[model samples]
Target chain A: MTSIINVSNLSKTYEGGFQALKSVNLEIKDGEIFALLGPNGAGKTTLISIICGLVNASEGSVTVGGFDIIRDYRQTRALIGLVPQELTTEAFETVRQNVSFTRGLFGKPKNPDLIEKILRDLSLWDKKDERIMNLSGGMKRRLLIAKALSHEPQILFLDEPTAGVDVELRKDMWNVVRDLQTSGVTIILTTHYIEEAEEMADRVGIITGGEIVLVEGKEALMNKLGSKQLTLDLLTPLEKIPESLIAHDLRLDNGGTNLVYTYDSKSDRTGITSLLNDLSANGVKFTDLKTNQSSLEDIFVDLVKQSS
Target chain B: MNLRAIKAIYLFEMSRTMRTLAQSLISPVVSTILYFVVFGSAIGSRIQEIDGVGYGTFIVPGLIMLTVLTQSMSNASFGIYFPRFIGTIYEVLSAPISHLEVIVGYVGAAATKSTILGLIILITAGFFVDLQIAHPFYMFLFLILTSVTFSLFGFIIGIWADNFEKLQIIPLLVITPLTFLGGSFYSVSMLPPFWQTVTLFNPILYLVSGFRWSFFENADVSVGVSLSMIALFLMICVLIVWWIFKTGYRLKD
Candidate 1:
């Protein structure tokens, strides 16, 4: 895969001595969905802003499609479509006009068919003649997507794309993104929703405090750090955990009716079979046993905590 | 700026402004009619003539300029400020349109609105008084120059403003007062020598005088000086706007 975006030693420092981004580097490949996960004010927006030419980077350099972002701004901007976190369509403008105007902004000749296709793809064709202010929030978000995609950009940046969106819109947007990916358009998405990252991202980059802590394949990150929980329901309630069973690092809950054990999923010995044998030997019998796999949420929380 | 992008922005901005037609065109016509009733009749009754022109006819250009300045400033500032207030500025800035294209598009729309209003006021003033145009060509020249200058000035205000209140600050405190005190109702010659000298500092004085010259045929100041001052003022405003766009001063960061 070819690299669509390359950042080297990128940092951003605002006035009055506030550092929004530290020295960081990242490479986003073409035709893949890359998710940047971070908490609020973690420089996700700032980084995206710099790449979009909305803000100037204080230090370092970035190139989009082999074009330096600052020097070759026109070409770079033409190559990239940005769906900012804000829902900022012209309120009084018809949806079709807004999308068409955006396409013309790139100096592209009028392409009514392309505009119609974009609006239809985003499910906004029905409201093509409606004013933007009359549309609901989800429709407005989709309109933003349509406007960004009107020029048929090679790469797209979605800054907090699904923030404050309904579940139906979220799912709908996921389908739209999946469609874009299938068409070979590279996507870089920043999201606070770990589930979104887990479901959509081919690779995940965890950023904390203006720095990228780790960038790895989604499954690899989970397998390296994800932990699983095993719960055993007791046949009868007990006062406390037995002294002999203290070596298992199990926690008793609900008046000792259940025992929960957490261990690394990647560990060679999960200790489940041995713990069950020991429990039987010690006369601590359970009527049932169940295991729950760790989710991406668990792995994300652990990564952010360790990095921070 | 790419001509295609600028043209697109220009068309878009114009459509947005036209959507508020009732408030844009009708409001000004109504207000101009009120000005004819209140200022032209009530004030004209007490005063007969100034500089050999009837009181009613003499105040026509100034009244038109007043409408032109205020309307242009309001339209331009609100047109851009609303997008920022609603967070649509990000969409505009992220587009392929250059800063210059954005400024020209918005300011051009504002100039169009104000020019149209000025023409309406001129026609409305004719209904109240038989005003004679001494130089129709110069009248068009001054009208266009004043509208463009104020439109650009309002563009700067739009970029600097952070909120709706900030957007109205210049129109309320600066543009309106300047028009009113800059001899919009009376000639600078009517004031004392010291005051007249001070009036020279009011930029709108040149626009008012320049516009009035085209109506009254002969005024205290030569038409050449008034037109020269207005032209120079427009050039300075254009330069500043260009610098603002080039630096990305308030609009970008």
Candidate 2:
């Protein structure tokens, strides 16, 4: 598969010696939802700003669809849509005007049919004639998406698209994103919400301290780094772990009401049978047992902490 | 620069400016009337005609220019400054619009406002004093030139201003004082040699004198010199605005 975005040795050092982005390399394939997850000031916005040509890169080369972001700015920018984090639209302008004007800015001729499709897809068709300031926050977020998609860009950069929005609005935005992906538009989103990535992203990238620590397929990352925990509700409380159960690496919890056994989910054998046998052999019995898998949030937190 | 985008931005800005029709259009007209009442009628009663024109008529061009200058300056400054204040400037910067398009849209709107106020003041000054139009063509030229020039200057002020206070500083401190001392209500020939020479350095003096000369057949200062000075001042303002847009001073950083 051809990479739509190729970033190499990207670093940004603002004036006054504040280093915002370290040397980072990343490649996002076309028609995929790639999520960049990070803590605040972890260089997520900075990276997006550099890619969108909002801020100058101190040292790096970024190409969108084989065109340099700085050299072929007009062409590269024409192909990319940037939805900034701030809700910065003309308050006095109607929603239709706002979106159409954005398309015109890209030197695109007026296409009313495409605009109607975008507005309807984002659930903003009914509010098209209303002033932007009159719309609620959720409607405004959806309008931002409509504006970004108005020009039919190949690559879309949504910087915290759902930040501070209600859950309903977030779901609406996600649906719009999925629709775009189905239409073969590559999306790069930076978000603090882990569930958003877990629900939508095909590939995940973790940025920490101005560096991209890791990037991998979502399922593969889970299978590779994910852990499984087997918890047993003991029939009786135990003062301590018996000598025979020590080899199983079982943790006693809830005053011996629960016993946890951690194992690699990817391993062919979970060793659960042997662990149960060992626990029973030590005169311990369980009334019920349940197994749980590590979530993306756990993995993300671990990756960020390890890099720091 | 896309013409469509420029038109869209221009129309959008103009609509917002016109929304407050009462404040935007009325305030300047009212203030101009006050200027005519206080400076023209009251002050002219004690002064003699200069260069064969009534004192009231002599000050008419200056008062009109003053209204245009201040209105142009405020309109341009506020147009750019408000976007920054409300964090909407980022929307403009992030859009695919070029810098030239942005400036054209904003400066065009500011010029339109100044021109409107100038015409209003001209119409209103007729009620206070009898005005002359020795060269209506030059009069129109001067009005347009002054409007465009001051609007450009105000565009620079908008870009350099860091806050609301900074936005008001240029018009309040610099443009206002210069207009007062630019031989607005009197002829430069009446002043002493030193003061006359000193007034020559003020750019507003050139604009006012040029505009006033357009109305008088034979004014103290020759119309040719006044036109040349206004042209020179306008060029300087354009260069300053163009440089700011090119270098992205206080904009890109």
Return the top candidate by lDDT: 1
Q: Which lDDT tens digits does candidate 1 get at residues B1-253?
A: 5677778778987887777778888878887778778877887788867888887788889889998988888888777778777777776676666667777788888898899889988998888899889889989998988888888878878878887788887788888888888898887888999999888888788788878889887565677888888778788878888887677777666
What is each candidate's DockQ, to 2 decimals?
Answer: 0.52, 0.40
Q: Give lDDT for model 2.
A: 0.84
Give the alpha carbon lDDT tens digit for every residue of A86-192 in model 2: 88766888999889978876678899999999999888999999999999877887888888888889999999998889877777788888888888999999999
Candidate 2 TM-score to native:
0.87
Best model number under TM-score: 2
Ten contiguous residues with the weakest lDDT in model 1 chain B: B91-100
Among all windows of 10 consecutive residues in model 1 chain A, the one with the lowest summed lDDT is: A219-228
Each model's iRMS: 1.6, 2.2
Superposed Cα deviation of residue A264, candidate 2 (Å): 4.3
TM value for model 1: 0.87
List the TM-score for candidate 1's chain B.
0.93
Score every model by TM-score: 0.87, 0.87
Worst 10 residues of 2 chain B by lDDT: B244-253
